[model samples]
Target: MQLQILEVILWPKAAGLPPRRVPFEPGKVNVISGASKRGKSSVIPIVDYCLGSRLCAIPAGTIREACAWFGIRVQTSEGEKIFARREPGKQQSTDEMMLLEDSVLDVPTDTPKKNTTRQAVKHLLDRLAGLSNLGFDPEEPRSGFQGRPSFRDTLAFCFQPQNIVANPDVLYFRADTNEHREKVRTIFPYVLGATTAERLAKKWELENLLRELRRKERERAAHDTVSATWLANLQVWVTEARELGLLRGDALEATEETLIVALEKVLAAGEEGNGFSAQGTGASADEYAALQTEESKIVLDLSVARHRLNQITAVRGTVGYYKGALDSQAARLGVSRWLRTLSNDGARCPICDSAMTSSSGELEQLCDALATIENETHTVSMAPPVLDRDLVDVKSKLSLLEDQLKAVRIRKRAIESRSKAIREGEQTSARVARFLGRVEQALELFSARSAPGGLNEELEKLNDSIEDLRKSLSEQQYALKLDAATARVSKDITRIAAKLDVERKDAPARLDIKELTVGVRDDAGREDFLWHLGSGANWLSYHVAAILALHVFFLRQLHSPVPALIIFDQPSQVYFPQRLTRPTAQSEEDDIGDEDVASIRRFFEAMGKLAAHFKGKLQIIVLDHAGPDVWDQLEAVSLAEEWRGNDYLVPKDWLDILE
Candidate 1:
């Protein structure tokens, strides 16, 4: 797809400063190169922010504060469109953006805010760029990204920020984050026409199905761990109930439902009293009532005796505790007496390690406390024997009550035994019926705990389905297509690298498609990849060539969804320092050497050749500190005046504008 930025406009918040507009033409390398801090690097972020970047990456200073809105005019297959995003406020940028379907030649004095959201603009861009809305599930929960590929995802290849342009470890913008790197990897094959939208969707669906299947299998395994014990208990209960004739079935062969039915039958038999007679040899009602009354009186007497015994036992324990405490107190009193004697003889205080004197009053008080403890201990010792006597009496009373209660209960049980025989036989059906109800509930719970028999079968079917889809995907020849595309991109990179005269032995032959990198064969014959190339010049050259090659590959494919625009922010940094005030003259001490100058010239020459090769389809924008002299021989436009003196991408006058 063809996509080019026609112009980038920064609207002033106040009327005093006019809008700043940087214009561009198609089929040429547009260089916004000048001195440092002249808003040369800000262009990439401004255009990216207008293109629906989540955060407003524009620096938070005079330029951002002065601008009310950031806008970009782009030419796509859907014709010219202008997108404007309001400058983020102190709090945050609003989701809303302004969009004009037609060409925007000049900044509008009164552009009205519209209800179009950032998401809507993204969707529109996706459509205009011919990107398929291919949906997919995240590899795991809370991965922070899901759904279809967006136009913003494609920008990883198109835009190179200053931090990444010369960074060897990074290949794409914002790829510093793992998630962004994953997104780039996932969309790389699709963006290059190596895989179809349908195939990608199916692959994601199969992956989700497999994840679900594994989750269900884990649940089944967990259930099995607990269900074994439940099943064992169920079998034991079934056997016991069967032996008691509460369940009338062969428990071994019975299903849960059958066991439930047998249990119900047993309960019904209990309710009907199927095997008992009403008449039996038992005591009369008068005798039984007289025994019950006698048992009640004995029980009350036994309870009173036990309560008194408990109180005596508690008193004995307290007396023993007090006796031990009194003994300890006596020993302490002896120690105090010794200390007092020592103090009177001019001894040091043991506690404070100072000269001490024992007062007569204090000694007397200690003597009184010791005497009291002695008296209390003597009294407590006397009480224990009394408590023992009381305990003896209570125990005697308790023994008599137990004997009476036992005699009565024995007689009562003899009478109850005859009656119970008759009642139990008569009520067997009812008892069994209740037991059956309980067993039925237990069986239901057991069945619930058991894993569903179809779970494994269903999982197998899913696996089979996934396998079939995999086979179908394989039949689509993704690997072959990807290999072919990689070869083409590698060839293009080799050609571009050679044209730039990058110093590397066998650079073309060392391009590894699987690794997505180019290597340099050293004197030791060891291959060093782009990330390990050390020098900033080699890093910058490799990135420029690789990125341009991928774009070239995309342009050659009729159905590739990537846009035909490349934005490079400071590709000249490898040749000059970041803090360079301006382009240096030939005689300057810090001037770029001839070799570096020729490399920069060749870089622009390669860009021009690629632009012409694509027949006015590709757009290249370079934001750097290079002068017009470096690019004057090539068909490149230099926005040098825009960065001259106080003028910048956002004009100096605009900095004074405030809302």
Candidate 2:
């Protein structure tokens, strides 16, 4: 991460006046030496505000009033990036920002518009620093800080402000507050190479696996929870499958395992086309309708045939009856023929041979009347020849009709019987279908519960994975490496402190993670906190030592996420509280006293040593009131800005608009 500040740009509020650009060089101690009220201390906050800080803490006076937009150009691995933020007025901060990126960036001659947001810039910066995209809390970033490390979190090591430069209570820049302290603590191991990116990723994986393990374990437990009830239902299901003919060889064993096998067999039977689906009555609606219609037509045809037969038989029987009556009369009238013969014998009784003439005439008359009656009765044709022929045709038709009617009656009975059977079979089929459906449902449930690749297997796998990840990600797992990293940083701190020669410089100095401050331990391992072991000079030197040591360690790591740039604002403030006029050839800092001059010299020298150690891999920016005489002999230092009478972060000409 080589995000070295190229320049701090302040576009003036007055129209048509070009922005003032304060240029800084890379990988060197770029110093901004100026007097008090020259906007030297404001440089840190101005740079922070431009780099996406939420607060506009750029000294709400001349610097804030004179500048319309605050911007910083920094060099990153992706080349130069310009991050400019509009000054927040009557507000803590604004999200409005403008971000520009290219291989080479120049300070804009005209004021740029807010083309992006502070959050967008922060993400760009985070990625530039090799920070992970998973840095934000899923629920809320402000909730617990389990999120990935942010670019701002690393800034706690990057900036050492005036108030923070000598504050022994806090080692990291923003560790004074709880929110910042915890965030820095969380990310320190990552920046120090103790916790690798692989470890963080594995930690996340472990949490997910643990959640999955819990859920699967619950499901496996649920299977146990309902095992007995399901077994009871399984027995019932097996019995149904057999009764529905979905299963074969039907005596139910009713044991749980056997019932499961039975269900599987039933499903197999369904697949083999022997299921209850094949147990239908095989009755068709069209067949039923056709049979019913034929039955009705046959019944009607039978009724018509019977009626025609009755009519023809009645006519024939009547003719025969009349003829028979006539025949009987004619037979009885045969006595008339005998009477006629008797009349012809002279009206004498058949029993007497002789008769009188008068008696014979009277008998003859009676005989004639009787004979006429016999003749008329005997001559009446019971059936004429034509009628007889018609009757014969009628009898033939009647015989044929009787045969047809008999056949129709037989067919109608058959249809009715078949229809009755179909209706009964359909009723039975409906019941069987419904029972089969229930059996299918029960079998599904049974198979799911008794499945082979069950929840227990998945749960076991998840537990195994969780155990592995837990081991890999545990803090104790990285304890030795972390301790080694801390030890190295502490050793550097002790060496750097020795040069500055602060109190307890000979003692072992260590960064107390829990205390979040530097601790110097004497023999018994008891120590004075940096806050307690302090004069102003002591606090300042220790602060510088701790910060520079951390940076050295950061540069040593192959893939440290901390920005390679560290900015110290007004580091010479404790030494030169009033100010130092830029020295000329005749006079070099006439204001300097013997009081702690060597300490300040050693202070810059330790910084110069680290700068020389990691030449091109690191950048150090100092905004101070120290003159050229104070740090000119050091070749590692570069002059970034030399603020004089009216020139500052905000020029005097830029402030005329506010006045």
Candidate 3:
């Protein structure tokens, strides 16, 4: 990827006043130099951040404030050209800040509040430029390679500031200290020759071994979990059976006897009869049958009797009642005549007082005359004639009906006698039938209780056998779980070994961390890289160098189209202490100072050579605060480009104001 940063402007974020801008050309190695507090290091990380490196420690406000101060704009490209610019306040710049191609701006930028220019550019590259392929995705931080970008991957474009004597792992500068001899050997493949590849393979082997062990543990855990469930269920069944006495060894006969006793108790409570005989007595059944037969006879007899009696009673009663009523009527009519005579006299009529009047004049005479006429008319009315002829005829018919009813009563008595005889004869059958029925019913009740419906004991035995088989299966499964875990660990170890290039001779059962080590070469005897190399800086450098060398060689073999630049921050921090050792007066000086210079010179020479080899295809940038002579030596290479210098400056107005 080719990047061109036009200019960066910084506002007064720290002690500095006002704002300033720095500019750089494309594909060039540029150095920014300044004293400690002048924002010299700011340029390195800002550019690094814009390029999608996650190592930057600078806060986002610093970039925003700086942009506001300098009125900055950036021009960049992915598949399409993009220009982005930002200014202070709520409204953000709509125009392209940087132009990848002269004709196209990268469309409209996301609103500033929603997305910052830095984030937008990162996303644009991830999609258009395949930045994700290179293990740097500013678009998404969580996704990508497992570890941070390594030393060899980023050596060319980034470096520490000048005059700082960091270790050679800084990528831009090399340390000559004797303590770093092994590291220098690893990074400079020429120093260790073909053996470096073997060293890398050794380190890979141990890592793979550890990875395999962990994988095995996980697999085992999963298998155990699955198998344990079945085992747990079996245990529960066994526990329940034991609690319910199913596990007791009593014979079926004994079990039946116990069940029979319980059944008898239940039957005694539910049944109506006393002992067997009480229960057996079908006498009630005979009695019910006899009663039913008797009732039928009685109903027939009653029907006949009732029909005859009803006819007779109707004739006799109707005749007598009507005759008496007519007689009474005649008597009432005679009494009524007597009453009329009394009414004719003027002392209030016996039946009605209104007929008597107290008037003394002609009105009283007229009222008395009207009363006498009314009484005479009432007395002269004839009584209704008695219907004696019809009554006499009905009395004759009633007498005939009464004689018929007497004959029916005699017939009913004969039927009742026959019914009673039949009832007495049937009682014996009922008693015998009831005894047999009770015995049959008792057998049915016992059968229902003893039998588990259609589920036979044979089937139950089969179920028990199946349960045993299932328990065995569960045990097998548990064993398989542990075996599978072992197998998984083995597979993982194999895979990681392939990746890490480590190996173990024995088919080990458990993990032995002490067996885990790092080294070069797949040779069987090799164990730890620490033992093979040295301690401190030398040891650390060797591993870092191996890592970088592996990457370079792998890329070359794959024929990948590598970027023109590589960037690395200070890596030697991990090994700086190792570079220090006990100092004898002269031995210390020679080791600490002179030896450091020689090592540094050698490191630069190696960098020059590597750069030359790839110079035909790419550009290289190295950043550092190393001695001036180092750059001078790098410049002597035939393929080297012109060096650019950088420094922080407060504008004249701010300087004057501060002063």
Query: All candidates' TM-scores?
Result: 0.60, 0.69, 0.31
lDDT of 1: 0.70
The whole-model C-alpha lDDT of candidate 3 against the native structure comes to 0.36
Off by over 4 Å in 3: 3-40, 52-56, 59-119, 131-562, 569-593, 616-619, 635-659
Distance from true location, Cα of 257 in model 2, Å: 4.7
Q: Candidate 1, 159: how far from true, in Å?
A: 2.0
Lowest summed lDDT across 10 adjacent residues in model 1 is found at: 274-283
Candidate 1 local lDDT, 425-490, one digit each (tens): 454455544555455455533454344634566567768977897888795588888877777887
Q: What TM-score should be assigned to candidate 2?
A: 0.69
Ranking by TM-score: 2, 1, 3
- In candidate 3, position 304 carries an lDDT of 62
Per-candidate count of clashing residue pairs (backbone under 3 Å): 9, 1, 32
Residues 571-638 of candidate 3 have per-residue lDDT tens digits of 22332323322222256443544544344434344444444554322332333333343334453232
Residue 72 local lDDT, model 1: 88
Global Cα RMSD, each model: 37.0, 51.6, 49.7
